[model samples]
Target: MSDRAVPATPPPLFDTAVVAGVGLIGGSVALGLRQRFLARRVVGLDASMDVLREAEALGVVDEVRISPGEWLREADLVVLAAPMRALEPLARELAPFLNPAALVTDVGSVKSGIAAEMERLGVRHFVPGHPMAGSERGGVVHARAALLENAVWVLTPTDHTPLTALSRARTLVEHLGAAPVVMPPAAHDDLVATISHLPYLASLALTHMVARDERLSLLAAGGFRDLTRVASGDPRMSRDMIVENKEALRCALERFRRQLERLEADLDEPEELLAAAYEGKRTRDSLPVVKRSLLPQKHDLVVAVPDRPNQIGAVTQALGAEGVNIKDIEVLAIREEGGALRLGLESPEEVQRAAGILTGAGFEVRGRS
Candidate 1:
């Protein structure tokens, strides 16, 4: 039940991974790669030496560097984990240092601008990746091993991108315990603008609207708290994301405004509007719950089980018998011969219960506190 007791195998892919920027996403990727892939060398680069040292001390990376230019040439894959505004400049700086065949990816929230810059720089091996995961928290200190597990990682590759490079990039993402979904550069931007960028703007605006009124702040409760939670994000990073994806975000905002106006106009017909809203909610809730990328909580666990018939059922049953409820479960690896199953349980107690059952049933289990 615990991450350490799981018998997950390393990914069969590249050995060396260099993360540029030891922030939340970057640090999480480094941790996932090192833990899941058993990467030969996981190196981290950051603008702040103190942050770099912290990342190394946290064991997210085997080593640390101050600049991407110093390590990019030798790394099999280079991941830019900085803010969107930094991606374009960093891409230009790293383009020359990158190995001709090495795969390059980024964790920037915005894709279109960075993708364009990569294309212009003739970075043939580039794959623009946006892991649709994160928390309001930022920085290396919040980096989590299961950050990308089961989360949708979108990659936008252009025609000029080499097939081999894209394949390797996908392998790297898989190794980091993420699900890679491919799309065109433009489409990726458009989709994220609607789902991601617009939401951030709305959250911030909602918070501002409440905070501006002294009396409203005092009356705010669970609904307002939950809705404005993401507004607590790092201002610099949020600003960068909004600016980098300005055009798409602007269009998304306009569409959202129109919807709001329609609802206001229908306020007189309360019952009809309520029914329409209820129908919309039903339709929205019908969609599959995509696993979101989130910082690992203190009591979380990642478990791995073999790819065998009835294995999942057996494991779930074993946990259920022990009264342990699984918070989340992901098939980290699935091969014809064997695979890895990662599970996130609610607490260490649940993990211990599940671990005892699975191990008693002859399954190898790893646990991470």
Candidate 2:
């Protein structure tokens, strides 16, 4: 018996899907495609035979190859999950073997350059994409199909891109449990620079500044640790991302600098600093919650959980036993021996039921305000 959970009705299946560069992002995409039954076969391509072997052993791909070849002829879908700079070169090599109608996409963070490169190479049916999801850890061993769940997968399709191609990419995103968002390539690049790239840089800067003083770094607690956590991610990958999108990132940096300058100039005025902090808190809180496709907006319930070996597992198991489906979850805060978990449920009734269930289980539960 296969361990794979094949859906009763799979989405439009690709005859064969090719994923180049089987690292964290590539491995995750391959797993997602196979687990969702969106591809009849998932083939991994990487320059490293060692990486390919790991991917195959991990069941991230049905087959693995060190390079692109005639196998591309059978591929109806191709995902370039390599670094931003390598995407064009890899695409060039695979273009000839790919079927004329094959739909191609990428997980490259920066889309504008690749979009232009694909067009320059005359590669039709190419849709530049980026999934706003990943982990600090890298490698195939760390890849999980759940990594992309409820993620915002951005598809930056040019006007010249065929509707059929864009539709197919969206279908793949949906089947992978991601929400597809359409935007221009340049616009996508600019937006990610501010939200994604800028944050990484900020984390990197903060971590380096504090680490310069060992005693000071040793004293770093909750907020400081959380703020600098991203600095622990793959430095090579982070370097490539910020460099590839430097122009937009520079603009974002300048905007941030101005904000800092204003705050610094008003350091003597405590009220001004407090007001600015309040403004930031309000803006951050007002950011719209992510709603997965094909599902109603989720209602949130906050549960205060005591720190214990299996507190989270116990809560999940208890909810599972009651057939309560948690659409999403987040660890809101942690202090000393306890923390709060926010659970997202389908309906208000489910929220109420979940609150009562947890409360009955001796947990302090509260509905979102």
Candidate 3:
């Protein structure tokens, strides 16, 4: 990204913006652009007429089309939200139609492959992006502007990419409520292999381990369910992501294997095993509440509430009533009877005010440890 600072009042980034493959990520981008009036017209392109109709019905886009045509020539911004395999082809097909000044980007998880393809194609304005925000559910029905809120959106710009184009892409990312992070495409792939791909495979492995025995499966509780949640995501999508970055993923798996071997060797040494567990806990505790750096810093308050109708809503309502805005939220634990929720606030002052509000409303509130 360029070093130029965005003015306090930046004009709309583009006159016409287009999003291809209007699925969860694509639809979310279209919605964000439309909601913020970042474009004069938001167009949705997909091979499925059904999807186009649904996006139109949901007001996710101002117009829908089956393919890129002459109108694409007017677009100042085009987001290729298609599958990883299809991105290169789609970019190639739309190249001749796009305005010379138009900025192009993608939401593909694996960046190195697409970055190389774009560089080879001489797509000067392209910026490869991966928004670290999504849900297990797929489709436009799950798309919403809030999905990208405070999320870290990574942009991988090749050496051929223009700085002005990168800056504009970053501006669009910020408008969608995401923090922009720039890094080499290879570095992005290597890092995500450890943080994302490996964890997903680990989730799958753990789920299979417990599921192999009916007795253990029947006893599975919240912790087991939470740990294996990613295994429940769309299997096809997971397969594609894992395979696309197999080289890095394999290296990550080898590192994990070594760690597991060390743990097994420490089984007979109780103190060593305990220390290993302690170190793991300390490292986990140091992760940011939200995955990025914030200026004022974010704080948290864990509120315990009964598992009743509207219980979660009541907690949020109480804080909202006190004008304490929530930055983010996560359910730490939930059982049939009750659960504890971790509410992220903007500052220590907001945390204090929120705690008082929830406690006044008859819910137990405590600061995050």
Candidate 4:
């Protein structure tokens, strides 16, 4: 054995990141890399000049490229945040432009299709990633800086994927303050099929079921609204996810059908079924709560304040004067008197600073734990 101590190599710094689709996920990722990693430059490529312009105005990227094929040659990291159907074609188009050593990844919810395409294209550095963070709303307009914060970002690396590329991808995810979990591609598909794809179909079905009965719309309340909320998501994107993950989704649907059948068979005794459902709720509630610290941590401050115009602006302005960055803000509640607002800060010290500034400014501030 050699006596010399081998020095650890420094993390690879991406010279430039190219996001192929400047929609919500792509725009958000570009913004995150620029803000968190201090990336030298970030370029966005989109077919829509309007979206490209919007992305530039939003500071999601340093520059926008009208043509994706031309910019792919220079990117150190190429992220495909396009729809599932576009991935195969995009990979084929990008293969020749990509540097042999550069890393390639996609934010597609389905991995098997993309991975198979990458294999066919002979792309050695490709890694399949899915960030489990999104809202029912779509497009760059709704893209948030803290969208990926504390979210479970899964990486499904195939046997052919290069280890160095996988490490770099994980580093990129960590830099964005996301929790990274690794699993086999098939397993990842199966898991997401159950958790994500199934819910989407169920939501759509629930929405359709209600739409058939015009009178049901008036009867719809909190539970109906909450359960079918995701049905409001982009129809195109939902269609893509369902088609791309068809096999896994089919299996999941079968399981769900069996459960529904059992419930239908037990429906004669409505009270017993209702009691069983309550027991199910109790079992779910009995599960231990996931500790906050166990998840990725971020600095945040919550404040209880009167519901009035300009109060938020005042609080934010005070913090801005202190040079503190506000990642996100949520107006939690509002009554005739007051409401609670939660502000996500960039650091714990900044949260304290914001609390002090708001409190001194005569607003009731709550320091979040």
Which candidate achieves the best TM-score against the true structure?
1
RMSD of each: 6.2, 12.4, 12.9, 11.7
Q: What TM-score would candidate 4 get against the native? A: 0.74
Enumerate clash totals for all models, in the order shown: 13, 0, 0, 0
lDDT of 4: 0.77
lDDT for position 245 in model 4: 92
What TM-score goes with each of the models?
0.79, 0.75, 0.75, 0.74
Candidate 2 per-residue lDDT, tens place, 1-369, comes to 875322122232587999999988899899877655557789999999999988988889989999888878888999999876788799889887888889999999999888998898888899999998888888988887667878899999998999999998997887677889999998999999999899999998888888788887678888898888878888888898899999999999999899889999879899999999999999999997765333233487656666565677767877899999988877643444455566779889999898788877777665532
TM match of model 2 to true structure: 0.75
Q: Over the stretch 34-53, how does candidate 4's per-residue lDDT look in tens digits?
A: 65432467889887899998
Query: lDDT of each prediction vs. the true structure?
Result: 0.78, 0.82, 0.82, 0.77
* Native-structure RMSD, model 2: 12.4
Q: Give the runs in model 4 whose Cα sits over 4 Å from its true position.
A: 1-12, 268-279, 282-369
Off by over 4 Å in 3: 1-10, 291-369
Residue pairs with clashing backbones, model 2: none
